[model samples]
Target chain A: EADIYQTPRYLVIGTGKKITLECSQTMGHDKMYWYQQDPGMELHLIHYSYGVNSTEKGDLSSESTVSRIRTEHFPLTLESARPSHTSQYLCASSDSWMLSVPQYFGPGTRLLVL
Target chain B: AQKVTQAQTEISVVEKEDVTLDCVYETRDTTYYLFWYKQPPSGELVFLIRRNSFDEQNEISGRYSWNFQKSTSSFNFTITASQVVDSAVYFCALSGTGNQFYFGTGTSLTVIP
Candidate 1:
């Protein structure tokens, strides 16, 4: 089993609220990513980080921001959340040295903005 | 450009029946990677298999099998005697540019008993 974990598997908040989604992995991976997905839809990459203090936006634009201060922790924060931001957020990590390996995914956090 | 396509949006099959999921991909790189992942209702993506461009040999694990055809640009998955436990959305992905991954929309499979 993968050691990746995401906190608050489900979340519901009012619009304009600032929230943070936590992601941690014990595999000591150097690459971490965040993806947004709707029910039964494809996953859209929103953010990723190569290592500590390195972050990049993904193919899909997102209002959320991510910070990688530690190898095990990559947290995403949404300022002034809106109902449009409501979706499932998935966290994944992979070994930097192995490009052919599959990414380990977390259980994912389903966010509902009221 | 790298892209993965899963043409079937959904499929329903009776228990003990066989099912196949189609996946077609496009990439500019000669050496790329193909992958399959299963996402249950729980929402976690479980890695299934990974195949490289150089190896076109088909693979089989238990009742699950994969067919890779470079000429057709297809990597199809087949499950024999599928069970209800196999019901889930399966996604096909392609990775050619380093760690960048391109994923298909996914094909939802429902195995009814």
Candidate 2:
């Protein structure tokens, strides 16, 4: 089945530690996005990629960065984690289309920084 | 700026009761896309419905229905004879001239048996 996947569903790390959240999709989508969401809160876009070797920051400023070295993978890395980074990170992908496009989401990774 | 607003934060209803979740959006673009997604306790979002700005026709799938009104910039979802399994957070989103989806603050629904 075509689906999106995320690794390290749950993580606990000390502040200032380096971490990378992995996201992959088998749907052959060209556009991928990363969003930050708190428990019982709204989703805020942090980063996105158009395709291989194409990445851009999202509406909400984030300390983390993302890379799209391959079309099937988009990983997000934080240089130094902080308590404010404690939240669920969601990955999504959408096929190329101008109108009426629907994005599919993956199981989120919940990170806790202490 | 594109924005989506889901007014009801949380709603609780009996298993057999009918419930409606309201969604309002704001966008300057003449054409846009709207979507509804359901997120269970497991925390993965599942797509429910998608409608374009030109298609004002209402959609019905199983016991779920969506009302999209371009004049009022509203897209509402209704679940008929709600079930315990229907308990989850529902979000409404808007896509304007790009790949990004402006999501609303989700509406948490609890269906009690």
Assess each prediction's global lDDT (C-alpha) against the native: 0.94, 0.94
Cα deviation at B79, candidate 2, in Å, is 0.2
**Candidate 1, A60-86: lDDT as tens digits:** 999999999999999999999999999
TM-score of each: 0.99, 0.97
The positional error of residue A50 in candidate 2, measured at the CA in angstroms, is 0.5
Worst-scoring 10-residue span by lDDT in model 2 chain A: A94-103
Best by DockQ: 2
Tens-digit lDDT track of model 2 for B1-113: 89999999999999999999999999999889999999999999999899999999999999999999988999999999999999999999998877579999999999999
lDDT of 1 by residue, B18-109 (tens): 99999999998988889999999999999999999999999999999999999999999999999999999999999887678889999999
Point out where model 2 deviates above 4 Å.
none
Model 1 chain B worst lDDT window (10 residues): B94-103
